[model samples]
Target: MKLNRRTVLSGLAAGSAVLAAPMVMAQGAPRVVVVGGGAGGATAARYIAKDSGGAVNVTLIEPTRQYYTCFFSNLYLGGVRDMDGLGHGYGTLAADYGINVVHDWAVGVDRDAKTVALASGATVPYDRLILSPGIDFKDGAVPGWDVSAQSAMPHAYKGGSQTELLKAQILAMPEGGRFAMVAPPNPYRCPPGPYERVSMVAHTLKEINPTAKILIVDPKANFSKQALFEEGWQKHYGGMIERIGPDFGGENVSVNPSEMTLDIDGVVEQVDVCNVIPAQKAGEIAHAAGITEGDWAPVNAADMSSKMDEAIHVLGDAAAQGDMPKSGFSANSQAKVCANAVLGALTDSRVFPAKFSNTCWSLIAPEDGVKVGASYEATEEKIASTGGFISETGEDEATRAQTYQESVGWYAAITSDMFG
Candidate 1:
């Protein structure tokens, strides 16, 4: 199946409701309130609104006026792309799809009343709610680091100003300075994000300050595309990057932003710049909705609906869906399945079988890229991977360059699919 938004939306509106509770009997058009306007929420809202043809009332609540993609923000650090290219406005979503795009933070979700409480003190009711609020760091995940220390250490995990700030810090580093990264643990957003970031930072330092060093304090023994990244680092940035995994006290780490020092195990090292990507949890709103278990919201594989309440759906990094990595492509893929199932419930449209695919592309150096991907199908237990592919260890320069070009194309296409 194509699984594109249009293709999923093309289901004829003449079938019986797929779900036991259709919500078609609601007094007027069924209302869907979506929280978070990133990949999952935006795509779901757009697909539902565009395909329903004004048959459904859709509202998207997001805090930021301009959404910046986390997927390609690493390139901005590498100086391959600019900050301007990363920003996207919601004007098109509103004017073209007839969506109500509200610029406000969603503070609380009242499942009992089926209402969402916004920071502006307004309450929006919904027959169904989709929460795609992305990842937030766990409190004390890194003992000595918090939001207050971000200005000094700068996580830069989320896009926009944090990313800009981190870039500025990297550029401001003195000659032969050190750049350190505290990589997150398992089940975090963007599996290869920290590694790719290390590559980008290394790329920049190589150009301006070749003597600078990059240190990675990773809790995990292994990471996504480890061999590919290691090979690239050795080839492009030899002897400049070093990684300390759990076996070397990487798991026991802390930071002193004010002192510009990192404490790995009992040893302390002063660093010029520190990028701390702490352990993560679902965004706050998901917890408020009473839908999350531990740190993530669990969802049904077929439709991305919350396990706690059927009326609510969760997506993206916030959702604990099986097999799929927490990535922009994964979120976009899940959104289509959720949209199709939602339309089937609200408009009596045909609901197709749930299928998903995700590919994560990482740029190791200029014009050098590697990727990992899988196709998935919804089984009774979870979304199971059917097959997969990954870039080889020692590919030719031409092949790596081709992979980089392919990633560039994907960025363009996925952004268009999102903002449009």
Candidate 2:
């Protein structure tokens, strides 16, 4: 159950051999190469492979052997769920779903030849390309934050070594040590992620060091589920967590990791642990392929085809999907819509208009959950939301409990949809 890199790769190898014939057929029959095997890419591969029924070839290219979901990652940090629960293997996508899993990074997109070049020196041509490479941090956005400092103060946004590093830092901190979190500006991946992480860290610190503190330095004055978070912090954690918004002069204007200090306006603050989540843009691959216009790729709402290039379809967090928050659920939902459109395009059939849905859950305590959800429908020009819900600002205890149950059910359903 604890799916790690080695185990997952071994599983893929065994499965690949068994499904070799089907894979060959799939490969030979009108190929589609999907880059990035994270939530969106993996989901697209699975659905296309299933629905195409060996008539369409689906090859998924990703460097990693296993994927770690950002959705429930905060639970892992809180010790509510084991890392095994968050870890997923692509063996089923290859074996049961008949998707060809290529364990290589996509180095180049040759639009002229309609092929993708791998770092391993293999060139896989495709009839169409679906890209969902996710988001990449914007360089120079935070002056002193770079790859080297990432080891000492891990962002944990990418969910691999950074996750382990942050976990270690928290575990190794002395009793009553301070943990400072710098949340990004609006429109980042997992809107509730940083807040959820704060709650989870608070959950851990309360047990290990009751007197320890968490300081959140946010750029925005208000955040997702602000009242609910405050209520939970006051009721259970009891002032262990403190928030500093821009209005309250909580901005981390500058950072110097070598000195272990952050300059907030004119004041200098020091902490045992630091988590800096910076501004972001589309992934490097999309930028290299010339699909991104500014921070994100613009795509046609009807089929996720790039507005810049019809042959390339962009999905997930990297796409500039107006009115759609960049969350794992949103990425997965968009992938399904993209898959259906790709199938229709290849076969020259009518593409069905899709309704997309997303729900993000955050755990402020072990069983307490806060959530925001939305349902969207596509128009001729844009993907527009029809309805949405946020956990009521001042809900009763019973309502909060019901939302928590819904959050748990959603986690189960989403993981099933992805890997089952």
lDDT, each prediction: 0.92, 0.82
C-alpha TM-scores of all predictions: 0.94, 0.92
Q: Whole-model lDDT for model 2 versus the true structure? A: 0.82
Clashing pairs in model 2? none
Candidate 1: tens digits of C-alpha lDDT, residues 370-412? 9999999988777889999999999999999999999999999
Task: Report the lDDT tens digits of candidate 2 across residue range 1-420.
Answer: 999988766775686433433624633578888998877888888777776766788899988888887778888788888877778888878778778799998888989899998999999999989998988888866668877788877789987667878888998888889998878887789888898899999999888878889988888888887887888888789979888889866664667888767777667888888988888888888988888888889988777889988999988988987778898888889989998998887866457778799988888888787788899987777789999998865677787778878887887787667665
How many residue pairs in model 2 have overlapping backbones?
0
Top model by lDDT, which number? 1
